[model samples]
Every structure is written in C-alpha cells, then in structure tokens.
Target: MSYVLCLHRWVGRQALYERYGLEPGMQIRAICTAESAQSLPEDRLASISTLESLDDATAVIAEAQRLIELHGVPHRVVALNEGDLLNAAAIRERWGVPGDPCAWIERFRDKLTMLEVAARQAAIAILPAVSAEDPQAVQRLLAEHGYPLVLKPRCGTASRGVRILRQAQDLRLLQAPHAEPMMVQAFCAAPILHVDGWWDGERIVVLTASRYVNSCADFGPDSALGSIELDADEHERAIAEQVAALLAVFAGQREIVFHLELFDDGQTLRFLEIGARVGGAEIPFLWREVRDIDLVGIAWELQTEACSRQRDHARTRSRDGRPLHGERGAWVIGRRESPLRTELGTLYWAQEALPAGVPSGVYEGARTRLRLRSFDRPALVRDVERIFEHLAQTWSASA
Candidate 1:
C-alpha cells in the first residue's frame, strides 16, 4: 500500500485522496493543529499527526520522517495542506526522497523574492511591490512611483490583508505593529486572467486558462461570485508560456507543480503570482474536464516516479480518462453589488447544501454558493443574472 503525507486536514486532502484512489486501506497522514486534528475523520485518525510548530521546513520534515519510518516508506510522500511545499522540499533533502526543491516552493510562496527573481529574469512586466515591514522604503517607492498602488502581505494567501493605497495618507492605517513587509505594487488596470497547468521540469503537460469576473470579491475571507469561461486564444497562451519558462528557470534542478496567475492589460501580459500547489476551485476541475488529466495524480507520479520510462504515468490521459458529458459551470456567491444587510433570497437547487434556502449575510468559502449547471450554460447565465438582481433588490429594500 502507498502513502502520502498531506500537510493540512482540510477539504483538499479529502478530495485528493478520493481522486487518486488512495482513500481506503492506503495510509493517509495529515499534519494539523491539535484542534483540527481532533475533528479529523475517524477512519484516517490513526495516521493523523498534530503539531504546534509547523512554521518552517526543518521541523515539518523531521516529523514526516518519523511517521514514514514507523509506517515504512510509502510510495510517495506529498502534502496537500499547509507546510506542504516546505515539507516536500525538506523530505527530498533530509530523507533523499523525491519532492519539490524548497527554493522553488519558496520563490512561489514568497512574493517579494518572486518579484525580484522575475525582474532579474526580465520575464514578465510586474507591479512594483515591496514588503510592508519596510514602511519607509515602500513609502519612498510610492513617492518615486506615485500612489494608487497595491499593498499585500509577503506570505499571505487568498488576498488576506490586501488593500489598495490610493494616496500617502492611506498609509496611516497600514502601520500595524505586527505587520510584516507588505508587497507594494503599482496597480495596473489589467483584465485579470489566470493561467494554470501541471508542469514537470519546464514541460507543460496539462494546461487550462480562465478569466476572473471579480478579483476583489475573492481578495479576502468572504465568499465571491465567479464563473468560468473556456476557449482562450493564442494571446493568453503566449503570456502563460513566458510564465512557465521563467518558473522553470526558478526551479533549477528540482521538479515542481505550479499554477500562475497573469493579467492582460489590454496590450500586454503582466505577472500576477504563481501558486506552488494546485490553484483553487475552477482551474483544477477545468483541467480534469477539458484535458482529461488528473493534476493531483500527475503530481503524485512526479514525486514517486524514478525513471524516464515511468514518466508516461505523469502525462495527462484525457483521451482515456472520464469524458465530459456536458458543459459545466460554477458560481461563487457573496456580498457583491449589495450590502449583506437582509435576506437576499435562498439558493434554490436540488443539490445545494442550503436546500431549505439561503438568507443574506451567509458569506462562506471561496465558493460560497455554486450552481453546477451541466449542459446548460445559457440557463446558468440566466439564473445567475436573476440571483444578482434578486440580491440587489433584497439589499435595496432593507437599505
């Protein structure tokens, strides 16, 4: 039996295990906080390990090794949750096991360093960003570059603690004592389009792209409504290729899996950021549907495969894997166009969690309310329009 060491005990672990056929009998180890560990599924509880100090790579890899030795070396050691990219690199280093290099993951995870490297490479146009810890330095840059800039945490995810600084006066609120260096970049009025794919070395095996309807909505801990549009063009592909090539340079000797977000400022493609792991929601599912490739599975093979011949397993198998029976679409609902002050209305659908109906102010996950209308893009569009109007009316009445 094979085993994979996932970093966090979140929804991602469950989904990966199920998708890769590693759920039952196979050992699935999860590293999480004590509180989260307690709530882990009973069947996989034995393999669940709790930790307090997973803030770095060394401690995490040590714990993983202990588990691996006790359970015997599993086929591949991978992480789906926190400290994963760190653990992956550490596992390869400490145990001589296969995993992504720490540097690759670090460059992807660390915004400042990523920008520096990208700039050095002259790979893609980027917004001028500086870590928030250097307030004076960022202020200096702002002075030189002007305002209407963006400030974001160096190591934050999903747009947490991100804010737009329109002028020098706006800097007052950003002076939190505990704030680390925030990445400050010149805000570009670019249409945000995300380019995602599975990479082995520099090779792009499975690729897909999408444009975001609302980037600001998903910028924080709130549910945001978004839908996916397929069929991109060569213009999008050219920019994605540049990102991929640059990432390949950054990874050097190590192999890695990556998801890069870029922007089209009408005339040019600009650098956004790259996620070391699989991207959230639509991108991952989109690849599987359109390319017939299981990015999760390919990542597993990349970590476990030893020889060039075995590389075929790492390739996408869309021609043979499950076929898409219908056109699929997903929508994330949240406080948008209206305030969350009243009963926006209920999400009606046979398969929704809130089948009883949703009241307003129920802001949830990245995908709060998704209507997966298969083979019905037109109907889905109409339904989404109606819902948005209903929400606006609901908020209007209360206001």
Candidate 2:
C-alpha cells in the first residue's frame, strides 16, 4: 500500500491533521520529534515514529529505510520546515523519488549563492556580498563594504546568528571562533520589505506585500517584530512585478510557493534573500485570516505536486482544486472571511529555540503573535497596534 511519509516537525494536530486527516481510505505516516508526537493525533496515522531531532539526516534516513521496508516507498516525502529541506532531499534520493529539491535549495538557503543567482537571472540589484569562509573574510568585507555591514549565517532562520557591525570595534564578533558558516553583506539603510505568494507555474497569482515594523534581525527579548500588509499603493504593482521576475529565474514559471525579502530605499528594491517555503512568524496566519488564503496549505500542496502528478486528492480542501489565488471567475473565493475566530490567533511567548526548562509557546519563538483582519484597512491597523500595546515586552533571553 502506498502511504505518504511526513518528516513531521510541527507540534499539535492543527499543523498537519486538523483539516485533512479525516479523509477516508487514505494512509499517512509520520516521523516526528518526541515533543511534536505528544500533540499529534495518533489515531489517524498508519504508524508513527519518534526522533530526538530532525537534523540528524543519518538517523532520519535509517528510519526512512525501515519505514520503506514496511510500507514500500511513500508517494511523497513531506518536510515543511526550512531546516528539514536537506534531510528531505536526502530521503528523496534514497527512495529514488523524482523531485530534486537539492538542486535549487542552495540558492534558497545559501545567501551568497542566492544573491548571485538572483542578480544574474533577474537583473536584480543585489547588495555586495562575500562569504565568511576565510578567517580574514570579515576584514576583507569591512575594507570593501565599510562600516555598518551585516553578517548572518548563509542558511539561517528567525533572525538567528545575525550580527551587525556599526563601528570598527565590532570586528571582534567576527574574528572570534564560530561554527556556522556566515556571509557578509553591505548593509542598506532602508525599510525591509517582504513579498509572499503562490506561483501557478506561469505568473505570481496570489501575493501580499508588507513592510516590517521592525527589521527581522531586530527580534529579541527586548524587541517586537511584526509586519503590516501594505495598502494599495502606486509602487505595489511594480514591487510584485520585480518579485515575479526574480521567482521566474529560479522556478522557470513553474509551480512554487515563495517567501521573498527585499530592501526598498524609496526608489530601488534590492534583493535580500528568498525562501522556497512559506514565510515564518505570523505570515501564514495573516494570509489565511486576512486574505482568505491558506498559504501554508498552498506550500504543502506544492510539495505533493512536486513529487507526484495527481491533482484531485489534497490534505486541505483547496478552493475548486484549481489555481488557489489565481484570477479565475470573480475570486468568488472565501469571499470576506468570517468574524475573527479566537483559535485563529495566538501569542507564542517561548519556543524550542529558547533554553530548556522555560515555558513553550505555540511553535516558533514569537514573543508576541496575533492575526487580525478587517474589511476596513484602517481598523485592521488599529487592532494590530492595540494588541501590541498590551503584550509584555520582556522575554527570557535564553536565545
């Protein structure tokens, strides 16, 4: 029997099974971390295994081999987190799967490679960058880019391991020993912008543009980070076009869900970095609650489409089983979303990224998270500000 095997890393049934697990005559197995397994609905899965951590590619592959022996090769191997991409790629290779996420995943993960590819293919203006491979890499980059340079891991998320050099004295942070490979970028003084949407293999059909209230790199126990979806503006169309152009370079006008970040200095939009998966934080919730779009589900569906051609069956009920947010007949759509649901919004005070023994929140280490929506744009903005005012500012600095 063919079963879909998920390297499930998310906690709670809400992530994978809440919307799709009830389907009759469908088989889905999952390998999850012990923490995630606690909340995952065991009654639905064909069988489930546990892992201490998903990063151990070798251990996960051994589990895959054993699972294969029991259930045959999965129709597709699913991994939704960025850290899980390479592990999933390895599993796909071992199973002789058709998809090769590894081919372009580097462009998505490695910041240096990601910038080079974007510049070469889309004619996008990318910030000058150098790899932090050599011990003298920072010294060289400082000489070239000058002060106020930014250094971050080539493959990182949640703004972890990011460092900014405001003065010459900051060089110590770079010269000090480190394990994670880093990249140096000439810092741009501008508002950080992000464009998120789903691609239908032709053009960008569904997208929302937002400018960060505070930079993603600013997240900390003391800082509050969030993004507000931009209202209709003259530059919106132009920005979407640029994002579409860059995505076309990597995807070749093919199906993909993307989270793209760029720097806009009121004139030119500079490419920062992009991810093949959905945007983290409250983006998925914002898309669903505010836009009547299931962005995370769209991302999940793209993977199934990636590994197979079957179109009808899906984990979540995609609208009409057609281009989800594409222009097709009035966007009759979910039409205005219903009254705000309590379960729809959450505030994550802590996460695994924090030190052990502290309390844990929903999933990621979002000190404060909420998804608000209103047909009136002005009211939505007010609601966001209202919640922000009441949230506690101090969080544990276990990060």
Candidate 3:
C-alpha cells in the first residue's frame, strides 16, 4: 500500500482527499492545525491527526513521524497550502520520500529567488524589486521607477500586508519592523490577469485566463472582489505563451500546479509573482464550472503521475460527458463593504426571484458563483458595470 501525508492549514482538503481516496491501495493521513481540524468533513476526520498549531516545525515533524510509524513511510508528502509548502518539502526530505525537497520548493516560496530565476529567462520582464531593509537600494528603485511603489511581504498570500506608497511620506512604512522580510516594487498600472493551469514537465496546459475586476492589492473587508474567465483569443494565447516561457525558465522543476499572475498592457506582458499551488479564492471552482477542469485533481496527478492520461482524456469531456468549447463564468465575493453587500444582495435576491436557469447558483459562502452569459466582451464589461451601479445606488439609498 502507498501512503500519502497531506499537510494543510485551511484549504485543499476536500479536493486532495477525494482524488487520493480513489486510488487503490492508497492510504491518506493528514496533519492539520486545530482550526482546520474543526472544518474537516466527517469522512476526512477519520484519518486526520490534529496539531495544537502549525507554527512549530518540531511539533509538525513529530506528528508526521507518528503517522509514518502507524502507516509506514509515506510514499509522498503533499501540501496544497502555500504557507505549508516548505514544511511539506522539509518532511519529504527528512523521510527521503519521492517529492520536491526544501531547496526546490524555496524557489517558489521566496519572492526574491523566484524573480531572480525568472529574470534570467528569455522573453520575461520583471518589475524592479528590492528588500525594504536596504534604504539606499529602495531609494535607487524609487528614483528609477518613480513614485507610487508597492510594499509587500517577501512571502505573502491573498494580498495580505500589501500597501501602495504614493509619496515620500509613505516610505516610513518601510522603516517599520516586519516579522518577515518585505519587498518594494514599482507599481504597474496595467490590469492584473492570472493564468490558472499546470505544466506537464514540458508544455503548459491552458485552462483559463481570468481578468481581475479589482486589484488583489485592493482586496479587503470592504472590497468587492471578482473575476471573469476571458474568452479564447489572441490575448489569452499570448498569456499562455508567456506562462509557458516562465515555466520553461524553471525547467528543473516539473509536473507542478502554477497560479501565475501577470500585468498586461495591450503591448507588453510583465511577469508578476506566481504561487506553486492552486490559485486561491474562486479560481479552482471557476475552472471546474466553466471548463469542466478539476485543478486540484490534476495537482494530485502531477505529484504522483497517476492517471495523467486518464485525466487528460477527462479534460476533453464535458460535465454531460460531451466535448465542450467553453462557458462564460464569474465568481464574486461579497464583503462587509456596503457596495458588495448591496450589489451581491440584490443579485442574490434577483436570482431567487427569477427562474432556475437565470444566474444559477453554483456555490455560496464568503464567495459566490453565478451563471450568466454575456455574448461579447463589451457586453460582459457593461454587465459588470451595471452591477456596480446597482451597488452604488443601494449604498446611496441606505446612506
């Protein structure tokens, strides 16, 4: 029997277990923090070993060793959470298991290392970035890139601790003590587009290109964040090529899931940082709903190289078991912000009042999915604006 050790903080459990549980002779054991343990489904709870906290590496390692004693050395150690990526890799190396080692995973976790590697690749342009601690280096970047710089953690997720510095006074944020290293970069004005897919050791499988309605940097409790899957076009094709080239630069690392974000100004594509796991938020669901692609399932397959051909075949099949071109899908998050509350509440009410097929509900929670089709790009953009207008009106009326 093959054993897989799954480490997580708060995400990817359902998808990971559902895929791995299907494999014959595969035993899945999980080590998760107390908070995540409460959220586990009944079936998942059966095989899980809880930890007081995920912060202590020593505690995590001890729990992993206990699982190994009970189930034998894990054939593979998997961590879908970005924060736990290094820990998972460390465990794999300690056990001499067949998976990415700490050094290999660090290239993806550390922003500086990731950009340094990408900078050497052809056809890739990276924004000038430097450690915030080096005042002279930051001033050099400020002089070169000009005002309106970005400050963020060297290794952060979900746009946490991200700040925009528009002037000299904002530079004070850099002087503040940070728990982890932080970086400063030239702020790009172009819209952010994320390419969600996988690399099969050679080629990038183009799943979908999503255009963010609002900057991730702007995402907050009061922000209404969303994305729409872009139609297959020249722009998407170009984005896919760039993603392929970026992955090729890191050719040493193969068979992994990548969530690559880039800045596209009609004429140029600038490389933004990427995450080595599945894209956060509603991306995985968007892919599944619109393209019938199971990103998490594919991620597991990539690690084990199990059922690659089968998954490839399945990708071509639609939800109804027929070939599909694509479908327009939108995933929106309603935050505590008045605009989102009003817009999303109105939309939810409308969906409930209307018939089943009109904006069918896919998933609901902190993030919600609605099925509505816009015939063309202009129409889609207009529709999104209309929702914002409704939000504004609702906010005004309430005020």
Candidate 4:
C-alpha cells in the first residue's frame, strides 16, 4: 500500500498531519525526534523511526529508504519543518516523486542565492551582504559598513545562530559555527515584520502580516518573543504587494506555504528572508484558533495533491494544483514566551488561563501563548495588551 512519509519536528503536530494525510487506503509515517514523536497519535502513524534528531539528513533518508523497502513506496513525501524541506526534496528527487527539486530548495535556503534571485525580478531594497567564508568579502563588508552589522547562517530558521556585532571585540563570539556557512549583512534599525500566506505557483491566494513585539534577533538566552497581526488600518496592502512581487519571482512547480520577514520602517520595507514552510511557534496555532484557517493542514494537502498529480498526471495532465482555501483577518495574536524572562528554550509554565484544550505541560516553543480575535481591531489590540500585562505580572512573580 502507498503511504505518505513526513520528516517532522515540534510537538502538537499530530492532529494536523493525521486529518489531511491519513485518509482511507493510505498511511502516514514519520521520522521525528523521540520527544516530538510522543505527541503523535499511536494509531495515526503506520510506523515511526526515532532518531537523535531529524537534522541528520543522511540517517533520516536511510531510515526512510528502509521503511519504503519494508512497507511500500510513498505516494507523497511531506516535510513541514524548515530544516526538513530540502531533505524531503532530496527524497522526492531520488524516488522520481513529484515535489520541489533540491537545487530549487537551495535557492530559498541559501541567503546569497535568494537575494540574487529576488533582485532579478523586483527592486526590493536589501542590505549589502557577503559570504562569511570569503575573507576579502568579509573584509570589504566590515570596511564599508563597520560596526553593528549582522552575521547569520546562510540557511537558518527561527533566528538561530545569528550575531549582531555592535563592536569590534564582539566578532570573537563567532568562532566558526562548526562548519555552517554564514553571511554578513548590513543591519537596519527598523521594526521587523513577518508575512505569512499560501503561495500558489501563480499568485498569492491568501496572506497575513504581523509585527514582532521584540525582534527575533533580540532573542537571547534570556528573552521573550511575540507578534501581533497587522490590522487593515495598517500597511496590510503595501506589505502584501511587496510579498507578492517576491513570491512571483520564487514560484516553483508546486504550491508552497511561506513565512517572510523584513525590516519595516513607517515608510519603507527592506527584504530580510523568507521560508517556504508554515511559520513556527504560535503561528499555526493562532491561524487556526483565531482565523479559522488550517495552515498546517493546507500545507499537507498541497503536497498530497501534487503527489497525486505526478502519480496519475493529475488526470487532466495540467492544472498545477488548486489554491489554498484563502483566509484573511485583521485581528489575531501570538507569543512565544512570557515577557518576564526565559531560560534558553527551557520548558516554562503555562498559566491557568492558557487556551482551553491546548496542551499545557512541557511544550517546546512557548512559555505561554494565547489566541485572540475580533472584528474590532482596536478593541482586539487593547485586549491583547491587557492580557499581556496580566501574564507579565503572573510570570514576573514566578521568576
């Protein structure tokens, strides 16, 4: 029997994958960390192979090959995590499966490549950047831009391994990063905004943007992260327009879910980076609970349809795959942790008012988070702040 193979991470993803992927006559299997796999419903996964981490792509692909040899070929390969995208693409390429190609994935994964591609199609303002490995390029960037520039992984997610060199001595913090490629870019002192949506191969069918309360770069060993969705009164249209232009440039053969970040001053927006996966942390949760949108399920369904099309030439042999069920909203909210404090990705408390039925103990992404929605955007923002005040007090006392 044919099955869907998913390279998954994070907790609380069991329901999303099961609902869309495990229909009658099909199976859903996964390669996930043991901690993450515990959340998976025992009955939903046909078989699961636990590993030290999904980041080890070689072991992951080997385990998948073993699974397929023992069970059957996967009709669809699914990968929702940012790190898993290329590995999933690699699997598809190996099996002659219908999915994104690895080279195409690299264009999005590699910071320099992404910037070059986006530049060809649009006049997006971007910070001057260079590969960290190139000594002369690094020297040129330092000489030109001087202090307080940014150095980040060429292909990083969730703001991991990023450095802001405010002074010369700070360069010592970057000891080489265990062989990961890095990029140095001029830093912009502006608020960072994120855009999330479904990008059909042709156009943006659905979109939403959020402004970070504290920039992801501000996140340190002791930090809190949060975001509030932009109201219609905000630059929702302008942000969407900019995102549409870039998405048009990066369109692939299959539909993709995107998470885009950029520097947004009141008058202009500068390109940061984009990921072709559902946004992490409280993003998918807020989208579902507040907007009645199932971003995760939509991602799963998009890949499934593509797989079917490839298997049967999609019946009509055309139509790249239908668009996502578009969802739009002016009010929603998410917090990655308490404003009081954090202990470097350590597990923290979820207060008594934690959203009903949402898992409570030991979730990885957030200390506490809530989903708020209203047609009254102003009222919704106030209510969000009020809750933040209360949660801050509760968490501060605990801290």
**Deviation in Å, model 2, residue 153 alpha carbon:** 0.7
**Which regions of candidate 2 fall more than 4 Å away from where they truly are?**
12-26, 38-43, 121-123, 135-140, 306-363, 389-399
Candidate 3's C-alpha runs over 4 A off are 11-16, 21-23, 38-46, 52-58, 69-71, 314-324, 337-379, 391-399
lDDT of 4 by residue, 1-399 (tens): 777888877766523654454546877788888767876767667888898878888998899889978987788888877778999999999988786789978887888888887776553577789887776887788899888888898987767778888997777755655458888889898999888877767766666788876777665434455566776534677777777778888874457778888888888788888887788666776666555566677677777773332222221221222212223222222243444343211112233344443442222344454454545555555655565565557656666
Worst 10 residues of 3 by lDDT: 356-365
State in Å the error of residue 11, model 3. 5.8
Clash number by candidate, in order: 13, 2, 0, 0
User: What local lDDT score does residue 104 receive in model 4, on the 0 to 100 scale?
Assistant: 79
Question: Cα RMSD (Å) between model 2 and the true structure?
Answer: 7.0
lDDT of 4: 0.68
Cα lDDT, model 2, residue 266:
78
**Model 2 agreement with the true structure over 262-351: per-residue lDDT tens digits:** 899878888988988777666665555434566666666666653221123221323322223321110000111122223322222222
Worst 10 residues of 1 by lDDT: 355-364
Q: Which parts of model 4 are misplaced by more than 4 Å?
A: 21-24, 173-177, 252-254, 306-363, 383-399
Alpha-carbon TM-score of each model against the true structure: 0.73, 0.80, 0.83, 0.82
lDDT score, candidate 2: 0.64
Per-candidate Cα lDDT values, in order, are 0.57, 0.64, 0.68, 0.68
lDDT of 1 by residue, 237-282 (tens): 5665666667666665455556677777667777878776666644
How well does candidate 4 score on lDDT at residue 30?
Answer: 83
User: Which one is best on TM-score?
Assistant: 3
Model 1 RMSD to the real structure?
A: 6.0
